[model samples]
Target: MRVGPVGVLVRPRAGVAGLVVAVALLGVAGVAVFSGSLDIAPARVLAALAGDGTRVETLVVVDRRLARTLAAVLVGFALGCAGALTQSITRNPIASPDILGVTTGAGFFAVLLITHPALLPGGSAMLAAAAITGGLVTTGGILALSWRAGFDGLRLILVGISVNAIGMAGVSWLLLRTDIDQAAVAMRWLTGSLSGARMPDVLLLAPFVLAAGLACAYLARDLAALRLGRSVAPALGTAPGRTEALALLVAVVLASGATAVAGPVAFAAFVAPQAAMRLFGTAGPPPLAGGLTGALLILAADLTAQRLPAELPVGVVTAVVGAPFLLYLLHRHRRRTSV
Candidate 1:
């Protein structure tokens, strides 16, 4: 559709990709709902979902499985959207909460308070606040350190990797000094399991996820402008600096929300956006598609963890997939730069 003097092209690639991802997510979630310890049959599970089954079946499917599924979706979306924001700002495929120490910093603070809850008065909620604060502060420091060179993508990634290492070291050192039970709890949380997800947990996370995602969506236009080049943003009447700063902040908040709920489930942030950008044929990652892809990734990983013979955290399954992808990305980048 176009006027006499202009032309318009409409593409629904992302819309289609998102639909496929959504369908896959539903299928995986259905399997997850039916595969837990109780082993309810599919027909009974469907009846329970429809509110026609016995009380125990209803409690098993609707109460536990459904809530856990919702939590997985929310956490995955938050991390995936956050990844898109960071990558857009830096124009770097691997720039994510995981690589930037945002998640590690949040996880460190969370585990610190977890191991020493006597130091904090507000219970798990307080720990969540600490995690978010840690990510914010960590990102602020990284920005300051990397700002010296005008937000170079390589510099940001390199500095972030260093900080991430230190944060991980801190977490390890803390775990070493703590009691076994506290360490055990922290370890499980760090592994990113949906085992403990509850309806209240989903409720606690939804608002922050929605808020940060909306902020990212609002910045999308500005982000599109920045993609032309940092210098071009000013000529186009956009403040690249401010746009980037705010985007990073919002992204950290998003990642922190997920980390608070799911313990930084590694590489969903790193993997989802790159996958979405390639699959949707976007110049950059589309936040909404990236988020939907992430939700599917986590849900499917959770489903896989459920079917495993041994009890495994969802993060374990994610890392198994993500680590290889990360290596491939690094190898590709290395080859490109070398050329």
Candidate 2:
């Protein structure tokens, strides 16, 4: 049943799951903060956070770890929201920005500029902008192709795959033509490391996530109805075409902004919403739970990456988990279709 004056949804299960995931994120952040050479007492960590502790504690808590933690949280939040929006609109379990070639699109242009710096005269932030531009461009092309293919949900995914292949081919071309050193640098970014995340990156990415997230919230009611089917959504007072348009736009913006900051970190967009769907037991991807799950996944992966002996890129860790998940989903779909 709905609650109170505004008639807000009262999903106890989802609310509790969101709370738990959020708490887990905070706990991971805490661990990341207090995990350096200096052994600041547990009780004093708060003091450091407040800028009242000794220099070492303050440096450890506020300066070093806080930025990284915020970066992961924001990037993960963006991807999660984008994925939730995508899955809801497509009404497909396996659909996501990563799966649909949005991340690949984002990464391609970023690498394009990286491999040829002479084409652009800007800093890392501009590189991030290039990635956003690439995602938008790729999305437009995919939508055009999907329209030609009858605007089917599965058809859109197929179109996305084709576009993604072209983008990957372009990336390969750029890498091959570049010097080994430059290609090495570009490949490192393609692998999606959070090692370079700083306060500046967090500051730049925050507003984009906030604005797009609010837009997603506004589209929630529309998406919920659209999930029933385009024909049925109209009976529920939803504009099917408009809702789909807005949802796709917001998803692209969210996913692109996150990729811009995190170097197209893979699978957070694909895996987070699926995990949240299971955790909250929702018929569809719940936005809030998905966002929380994304944040937790990224933060945990980053923490794990740091603790590892070789210090792998964050995307590498996620791909290790996500690849199998994708295969499983495909196998399940195959079985159902066969039946």
Candidate 3:
């Protein structure tokens, strides 16, 4: 399907797959909202959603679970889209915000601010601003280091890996400098928790998420062409450099906002787009499908984490699920290259 100047090739079953994934996401969200420690009945949850529930039920659903759930969904969607954009731009299957150090960079700044309040004087808004700045700086460094002749995917990935290590080390150093209680708090944030997420956090992040999403949708055709190659992209009237820069900006913003809100959520970004492509049977990342898949993944992981005897971070659950899949993907890629 051609939209405007770019062509979007959709598989026959893509729509159906998208619909199925959307329904699954809704179901998972419902389970997440209803199966918390409070254990609101599904019917009452629906009533609360519809503004027709008892005071306590309304508070549980509206004030507590709903905000957290929405935050999860928005963050997941942003990360998924960011992942898809990064993978497509780099033409690297393993490329994601987390792996590329964007999340780590953002997390580093946010943690720094949390541990040392003197850094940023403002509230959550300033913290988010710091995260965005950190992520963009990291991205800029990676691009500058890797751009010898042009943007080389292999070099970019290699540089990103190194940068991620450095960022993590910085985070570790900060954590070590803090006292036990402070370290514990920072550790939870680093591990990614949605425990006390409120409507304000969601509100803070929504604009960035929505804006990035719209920009990605608009650039979908260009992204598809760019994935073909530099030569082909130019022929298709897509400026490869500009498109890549814009795409990276979108990714950095999305990732930074999500990290600011939920800390670094492990491999949600890495897993979502890859899983979506397989499910949608697309040649490249399907942004919408990826977003839905991410939402479902996080919601499911959060629900599981919440239901555990001792509550675990959502990042821990996602890491547990995503690590094996990543290894499998690497093996498969190696096999294909060898062939």
Highest TM-score model number: 3
* Candidate 1 structure quality by residue, lDDT tens digits, 134-225: 89988887878887757777788889999999999999999999999999999999998888888877888899888877786678778888
Candidate 2 deviant stretches above 4 angstroms: 1-5, 37-48, 52-60, 335-339
Q: Please tell me which predicted candidate would have the highest lDDT against the true structure.
A: 3
RMSD of each: 3.2, 2.2, 2.3
Put the candidates in TM-score order, highest first. Answer: 3, 2, 1
Q: Whole-model Cα lDDT per candidate?
A: 0.87, 0.85, 0.88
Clashing pairs in 1: none
Candidate 3 C-alpha lDDT tens digits along 241-283 = 8998898899889999989888899999999999999999888
What's model 2's TM-score? 0.92
Off by over 4 Å in 1: 1-10, 41-55, 337-339
Residues 55-161, model 2: lDDT tens digits = 97776777667888899898988899889988888898777998799988999999989999988899888887898899999999889888952457788889988
| Residue 316 lDDT in candidate 1 | 96
lDDT, candidate 3, equals: 0.88
lDDT of candidate 1 at residue 60, scale 0 to 100? 90
Q: In candidate 3, residue 295 scores what lDDT?
A: 84
